[model samples]
Target: MFSFEDYREILRLVKESGRYATYGEALEREEFIIMRHDVEYSVDRAYALSRVEDSMDFRSNYFFQWTNNSYNILSRKNRDLLTDMHERGHMIGLHFALNGMTDMELIRRRIRQEMDMLSDMLGFAVNTFSIHRPSPAVLAENIKLPGILNAYQDEFFSFDPKAGPDSALRVKYLSDANHIWRYGYPDAETIAAHPRIQILAHPFAWTKKGYENEENYRTLIREKYAEMIDSIDGECKDFSPYREGFMGMLT
Candidate 1:
């Protein structure tokens, strides 16, 4: 139910408190709030939020999933959007899922392989990464990549399942997962309480209009549905003339 305006307020709070850095810049810092977004459902939504950040002259890390079923990173539309975001000075990186693999060596290879592929597609070096919904085994591995900065690395994050918003840990972690604040919402007080924090806000949960929770998801579904129809129109000449009518249905 968060509006882009609400998101903007959070951004302003962090920026004013301001020891925040992009993953690349934070590598040199002792304490920072790593402003990050893992694009989950919609690149279009990510683009919307990125514009908000851009308007504020703010920059942060954005991670895109390589194997995401929701959107194709290789598609021309997505490639252009992602590359455009990078050109605007926002850090782009891989949002990876270990997929339950436990062998540390094998995990390293998998990460690098995808990293290389993602880098090639973006036409830039993607040296930072964040894991998507890491399981206990994935966290236990503490998977490391050479010459790369992992957002979940022990130096930046400490995983404690029972940890709460007020719990004092090595590093504070706040997330906007499942469209709900999993830790504590970073109000002025909540944010000031943590010296070192990592904020994982998903672009999927936000919008320009910022509808109520149920309507927000319904809107996303319609957007995805239209994207599917557009793809169908591209590959199926028979659907070409029908595209507008199908699109109108959603409208």
Candidate 2:
């Protein structure tokens, strides 16, 4: 298994080298791809992502769950690192577990718990949220919940095909976990480049070459960074710093 540090190097090449492409450029060249990752407490993976940020000289959103053992969300080290990343301009969002997907009240309570937990651990309020293992039905139903989904803060849902484009679909992304682009979900580049900000990632996915793995699902993630980074090289612009025009309303 490739360590997270290896992943960092991949990102580094993209940001620092300028050799790495952006979504904007990739689209024009017919090779647009975006590199984003969701870290469920896989410290090694997270570390690699951090390195990638360092290498690229840019920060990408990292969604973390509070229930995993890879790293304790409450650990001071975890808190400090999370806060440090945020302070350094990286985004930190909630990785909501499946249990919290059903009940709005439960979701609300859980959000508070998660936000408070993260705040206590990282010394900041957790606002943004993304659901893990979100099924289309669950996503649509969750959207109907009163104070969950988009209520507390930004809710990250992998594109809901049923909800269609008119709904709150924001970012589009796929998991590279198996060395292949997660073909089941919506296209991430389109979502990222959308009017609203899109958050996407799969920390566990990568190929040895650092480009995206298209040949087969193997254990090489770093190798495909070039292809992945190049894929998004010009398809869209970064939506970081978060535009405030929405006024906290879920449109």
Top model number, TM-score? 1
How do the residues 72-139 of candidate 2 rate in per-residue lDDT, one tens digit apiece? 65555566677677787676777767663666567657766776677666766566556666656545
Candidate 1 per-residue lDDT, tens place, 102-187, comes to 68788788889999988887789999888888876677677677789888887778877777766789778888887778778877
Against the true structure, whose lDDT is highest? Answer: 1
For model 1, give the 10-residue run with minimal summed lDDT: 21-30
Query: Candidate 1 overall Cα lDDT vs. reference?
Result: 0.84
Error of 2 at 193 (Å): 10
Q: RMSD to the native, candidate 2?
A: 16.7
**Where does model 2 exceed 4 Å of error?**
1-36, 142-171, 184-199, 206-251
What value does the lDDT take at residue 119 in candidate 1? 86
Relative to the unseen true structure, what is the C-alpha lDDT of residue 194 in candidate 1, on a scale of 0 to 100?
80
